[model samples]
Target: MPESTYPRTALQRGGVPVPPLALGSWNTWDRMSKDEAVALIRRATELDAGFFDIAYYNMGPHAENSRTDILFGEALRASGVDRDGITLCGKLWLWDWPNQGFRQQLVESLGRAGLERFDTVVVGDYGKVPDMPRLVAEVNALISEGLVDSWGINNWQIAHTTQALDEAETQGVVAPVVAQLKYGIARRSMAEGEAYGALFDAGVLTLQASDVFEGGILATGRQPERKVGADVGGIREQIAAIYPEVARVAAGFGVTPAALGIAFCLSNPATANVLFGASRLAQLEQNHAALELALAHGPEVRAALAGCWVDRDVRADGVW
Candidate 1:
């Protein structure tokens, strides 16, 4: 399928357009070598997956060495695609949620990406509610200065999102147009149950990550080695047992496990874009297949997958 034929969704802020599916470089690029990471990014772009999400403080103590954004910039230059054809997205780390820190982080992200501007920059999870006001202010400053094309928050609850929007409106700044969250088959309640209704009512778009393979559970079909504690391990095993069923459903539709996993997220009407993490070129190719499959399914297939949601509590720390 042609790149233009792929499903496109527009965000509420700046009416900026992004593909329904985006290539994410969170844990994938964090663990891979620079050369491998760059090749996978270029391959994703070659396959017409133009949206890429890179986080600055992903690798914990070695955060300084976390050059995913820089590698992505190099890949983009190598791909020979015009900057306008790509949508680059990044986040402000939790540490940068303080006064004017978000703006400073935006400048750093732009410098790493080697771009004059970014399509979207999300304020990663705020550790405190009070910081929301300052973060909103910083985002507005960046947007007003043309340093950021659009701004939003990630993992914020309904009340916080509403508060931010109200604050932005009071200051005569653009309210956030997108909410980044983990929304998938087993993880629908937090996003799709109540919070999603509130966001929809308030006219906020959603950019969903971890749509599949949360904590490497779906991809490995085994308990994630990185997960700690006994309770989390038990929950991981339970979720792992259900992977075969997920794979079976995908087989019925002639798709891969990853494709079925992503399709489950694309089924949601509120989802403006689906974000996926790929560690290698092969994984990027597989995710590209999911994007095409989603486009082919259209409305009916999405409706069917939406009905197949299973309730489970999958937390960032571990399985809840």
Candidate 2:
């Protein structure tokens, strides 16, 4: 499964094909200048990474405007990548729910991307079971009108995702083809546990983000000194302790630490794609190298790395 050998895995979602690995513009956009962001995106396109995930609410609390998507749109136009060959995936944030607000948000996403329509629009993390019906309905409506080619959910539990799919079936509409979940060596429940089972049975595609364990915690042996809000910091510490072993395993395959982390996600049968966020052209080149590394590492190497999930904090409840 070397990056080059794989070419790019494509899955049919809502009768459209989407790239198996998507370029995510989250922290990458926040950290880079607008020009840097555009360069990184262009580099990804040059490498044939055909999907970009942009968020309208990426700028942080005080920022009323979403410059990230706009910058991405400008870059796409400037690069001259045929819109037909690329898939633009954006999110519908919590604040932009309900009819009018959601419609406005969708319009803004299109405006920002400088595209006529998105290939996939993920309505993210409803957080509760009750809210799913409305969100699914709204997303289906958007799909019906050709505003978006497909719909998806991000950061949701198995139960909530299943409920949403059930609702979609009841309405005779397609359920989400993708579920964007936090999945990596440091984060596994959503991919390995009951959540994966539910999604698999329902024929939903799995899209994993934060695959490098959020900035080298799992891949680079670096952990944050301060405890951020919630459960992530502790897990990072645990992952830091195991980084040497991870590096050793990666060395066995002659790949970088980041590639090893990504390969672990790709090894999962449920995973249809891995989402990577790159702030620079160099970073995009490094991350895209995973495709080649994957092909070089055979089943034995993949099984060995998969068996290396030994950190307890990562397995603890609330980590997912």
Candidate 3:
């Protein structure tokens, strides 16, 4: 059976209403100049994409650059977006999820971003798989200290996230609500495969989906470099194979493939927020417009693109 698709408008993070689209700063460093990046941040704010996504990994050499939070801070300060108006979501490695290590990492991340608190902090991918009980304790402590509003996991396999949620429930701490994962036409394992479909069925709704463009696969104009963890060549082929169909469907609706892709995710009723990345104001505006168009044509596009999902051996290929 095909995975169920859902559509939802907003979700509350620390009492703030989050729109369905967010600004993702993954590997955005050096893609544009500082001034341009700041302007882009302001642009995102104007477009209601104020839920900014950042992580420590985005700052390290893996991206060949650094300090996404710092960049966002600069943009926020310059853009005049009130701290309370926009929400910041940060990611940490599992190794930092226990004891003082988690707290210290949060402190550093906050300091770098020039903020006292973030709306949500997630343990990005299970690196060494932190001790679940201790990890929950550390997360609860942060919430108690008011250092973070809500907490969750990102990029964790279904089994790990399921275990984390169960343990959090057993331990009587706030369970992780937002489980960030990759989901798009090019990366359909989590969305269509049973691995994460079960999670949605389990009542988890806040799925902050990133890479909706599939590392430049679905965009209309010149695509920026693909900057994510996946089989670049293989994904390119998958996108190539589907581009004609996506373009045809998009043209049929008088929208771009980018809009088709975003709409495809928006079609999923359970997805709370879909994250998109941009290094320029124009791109941000484009995606923001596409987001609204997606909402309008979400169901139709989902039906059209039903056969375009890259549902290869997900677990065997390690995409999960």
Candidate 4:
């Protein structure tokens, strides 16, 4: 809790400590060369930011047949970074839930990653409401089987997240310790709003800040021709329009907009860690400064970007 210390805490119920940032594998991670991936992995570990949120990316809108998981496995093996030295958080897509089954997804994802187990698995992205009891039981079964050490919810509604925790607690099973949501300078409502904030405040859950850059749009201060994550509240344009203000504020802090956006998320007391995607080693190195930024001028940065906290109506409904 010291000002100089980058917060490291157990993301799992009784698991090893994780750092303040996690590298995400979603869009551009698959495009990295093996050597680049290896170097990035090494540099991330060197920075003590070795936690990873890896996924197979072969379901729903992500069914582009990406080999990001496979590539990461290859890079890890070549990087020679000890597997035990890093924490891996995989994803279990609820897109095709009961039919595909968590077990099959777990097996296939681990196989793709060339790993035997994930330290944590996030059950995410469902079209409809899933059976809470069944989901909780399956996650518990995975824990017992040692396929995953722990589990958490991703983009889940506040009510459903509470139900999952209640079910697990009532059944005398392990419950989630973190809630991964789209949270950043532009997207703050879900993670900081009354419902989810209560969970974090009451010591029931910690926030995992994801999409801090809105898939590079917020970082670049310009919208790409390609698509991005859910435009919840139809506010992507509003978010884009506010980029100049973000850049202006970043200029005052003597940091890049991307670094300030990242630091803003890390500055929040409720955020246990922030997930960021970088395609280059330089980008990774630049982002490492965010920890110091968060430590030194966190409150001032938060207050500066107060105007960019748009999309207050956004909630964790498990859709995006």
TM-score of predicted model 2?
Answer: 0.84
Query: Per-candidate TM vs. native?
Result: 0.84, 0.84, 0.86, 0.95
Q: What ranking emerges by TM-score with the best candidate at the front? A: 4, 3, 2, 1
TM-score of 1: 0.84
For residues 182-250, what per-residue lDDT tens digits would candidate 3 score against the true structure?
Answer: 777667776556767766656664677777776776775334455555553355565657877888888
* Model 1 regions more than 4 Å off: 30-38, 58-65, 225-235, 296-320
Query: What ranges in model 2 sit over 4 Å off?
Result: 1-7, 33-35, 58-66, 127-130, 224-234, 310-320
Candidate 4 shows a clash count of 0
Candidate 1 has which clashing residue pairs, if any? none
- In order of listing, the candidates' clash counts read 0, 9, 5, 0
The positional error of residue 85 in candidate 1, measured at the CA in angstroms, is 0.4
TM-score (C-alpha) between model 4 and the true structure: 0.95
Say which prediction, candidate 1 or candidate 2, comes out ahead on lDDT: 1
Worst 10 residues of 1 by lDDT: 227-236
Compose the digit string of candidate 4's lDDT tens values, residues 154-198.
Answer: 888888999999999989999988899999999888888888888
**By TM-score, is 1 or 4 better?**
4
Clash pairs, model 4 backbone: none
lDDT of 1 by residue, 1-320 (tens): 23554657777744766766677755455567667766765666667567888766543232555676777777667666667777887787764346447667778777877877777787765445656567677777888898777777776666777788888888888778887776665556556655555666556655555445666566556665553212322444555667777766778877777777776677666777778777777766776666666667746555655544455444332123
- Write candidate 2's Cα lDDT for 1-320 as tens digits: 11233545444433644555678765546666767766766666566466788777642241346466677777667666667777788788764345335667788778776777877888764333446667777787778888887777776666666777788888888788776766777666555665465555555665555444555466557764422123443455565677888889878777767777776777666666778766667766766666666556646556776655644334322234
lDDT of each: 0.66, 0.65, 0.69, 0.84
